[model samples]
Target: MPETTRILLVEDHPLIRAGCRRLLAQRRNFDLQEADRGLAALELNKRHRPDILLLDLDLPDGNGLDLMPQLVADNAPVRIIILSMYGDSGRVSRALAKGAKGYVTKNDDPAAILTAIDKVLEGEVYLGQTVAQALALTQLQPETPGLAELGEREKAILDGLGDGKSLAEIAADLGVTYKTVANAAGLLKSKLRIRTSAALVKFAVERKSA
Candidate 1:
């Protein structure tokens, strides 16, 4: 590790950013910076070359998941930890698959954030308690046929469906067009072996509650 563990915190919410700043302040060796948007994050990552990135999935300009590739392209020695409001298995899986070294939800005990930083710095992947349990449950459950083959976007759409969101609402939330979400939902029906949109929604709801 560098003499000072430089960290860039990317979050749009001011209170959350302040809380993170205070928490990280407990560590005498930490050097922290903040960014409220994806573009700013990329610029800061380029200039600061932080050792760790505490990123939020929701940003003002774009989805944090979509921004990961640009940050990774910086070729810095930064390890990313997602500090998200979402603790669902699909989001966690997608974050890790995108090269996040740690996954910590906002609802998790605040101390878990500090612990995640320590673990990632020590070269280990870290998952918050809730995230771990969610992933474990997802693995243990008998998934519907073809569910495992769904891509990240498909899984996200399914999650939105489970949350009782319409395709238009999901499109807005995901920063995509309504047609895109509709097409994905149609594809989801075929993949999950469901014949109708209403049946697909039922399956998603049941699976989410399971």
Candidate 2:
């Protein structure tokens, strides 16, 4: 039999962690361990050198999506599988762009979680279908930064919005298609919780001033 796979799970919710622990326990190949935050997970990495890390993007102290590069900065190599409540492409893409090995939405079938882990452990990049298609579109099309987390593209979008450019105008200026810009705006509206372009503009202006 293959050796037990040491797994490090980082999540803030106790009930969720307990459920995950139970699920992994049922899989004979895994040896489950748990932590509550990105910092704690990194510490455990230093001591345990786990084979796989099941990371939750949202945490009490910080975000796992932002922690991927740091997790890989050292000489040690660890596979990261992001588990998040967010099913949006922007959020999933952000995690993958930061070097995470896999991404799974909480709403996906439970088997998807296991599948993501297995794929990463086997050294394959994994993104759920919805996330994968989103990334594909992100690469093939032009998009606005409204829904994306704090990233370079997001900053550019904010700057443009703050400067009072319409999505069509911005898309034209940016050399991307109009629909892509519209989609990005839609994402931005949902992510930023703004119902109108005016609100988005206001939010951007305030954010820049702050």
Candidate 3:
């Protein structure tokens, strides 16, 4: 590890950013910079090439998940840890799959956040306890056949649902029309043999967490 650990903290909320700044101040070796928007975060990243990136999922301009892959690709060596209020398995899975070294919910203890930062910086994958428990709980449920049958797009729609995102939000994130996203949701429901939206959501949550 570098003597001075550079960290880029990307969060839109001033109070949350301030809290993180206070927590990060505990580490004298940390060189921290903050950005309120995704674009500004990227710009700051490109200029400083921070060793660690603490990103929030919901940004005013774009979802942080959408920017995660780009940031990871741009700064190949940087350790990215998602710090978000969204603790659903779908969001956690998506962030991890996109090359994030760690996922820490905003509700996690400040000490856990610091531990995550240290562990990820030391080349280990770190997941908050609640997130880890959610993933572990999936192991107790039997696998659903519908899980194996869903196509890529179907899975994407279901994942969005599991993450508690509305059809419009999912469409915006996927860069598709609202109608297209609605149609896809309908197709997934039909394929999964689910009659109600609640049932589909249950199945999606179960599958994603599993």
Candidate 4:
């Protein structure tokens, strides 16, 4: 007899939570708990120490991304699979970067949730089909300059920017002059066809994480 997999379902909607509960009921190897908010999820996580966390990205008290690090820390041996409504690559990348083992949107087949759980439990990273397809399409789409089109220096500059470093700081870290870093930033913005520094920064951050 296999040991039961303890699962904590952290979702804000009562109806959705109930539906998940009903679905999990068919799996004899799973023991499920529930939380409708981030704070409550944290409390239950600390108390129950579940083996797998099926988390929703939007919670009443806070965003699920904010809670992922804490839950991941508290449950080191456990797996976290994000069950969210958002399928955007940036969100998926951030959640995975923050230590989530899987990403699945609400729009995915219901069976995908179970599949994600199983894959993550086995230490694999799982992305829902829709999310994966969207990422693929986004990557294939034409642009002034995609991530793959960047040069080594530009890549390094973008990495530094992504880390929220100042231009001078990046220059110091890279052992280059401030002017050199600034020039690189300008080229990056031009090549990416982005109009503002804020957009460049956001792009770098999202791309680096992705």
- Indicate whether candidate 3 or candidate 4 has the larger TM-score: 3
What lDDT does candidate 3 reach at residue 166? 88
Better-scoring candidate (TM-score), 2 or 3 = 3
TM-score winner between 1 and 4, please give it.
1
Order by lDDT, highest first: 1, 3, 4, 2
Query: Order of all candidates by TM-score, from best down to worst?
Result: 3, 1, 4, 2
Pairs that clash in candidate 2 = 146-188, 147-188
lDDT, candidates in the order shown: 0.91, 0.76, 0.87, 0.86
Off by over 4 Å in 1: 149-191, 204-210
Clashing pairs in 4: none
TM-score of each candidate? 0.81, 0.67, 0.84, 0.71
Question: Against the true structure, candidate 4 has what lDDT?
Answer: 0.86
lDDT of 1 by residue, 1-210 (tens): 567999999999999999999999999999999999999999999999999999999887989999998899994578999999988887787799899999999989999999999999999999999899998988898868999899989988998999799999999989999999999999999988999999999998877655
Whose lDDT is greatest here?
Answer: 1
How close to the true structure is residue 16 of candidate 3, measured as C-alpha lDDT?
96
lDDT per residue (tens digit) for residues 50-123 in model 2 = 77888998898887866777677641578888888765655665577788889877677777878888888788
How many clashes does the backbone of model 1 have? Answer: 0
- RMSD, one per candidate, in order: 3.6, 9.8, 3.1, 6.2
What stretches of model 3 exceed 4 Å from their correct place?
160-187, 196-210
Displacement of the residue 11 alpha carbon in candidate 1, Å: 1.2
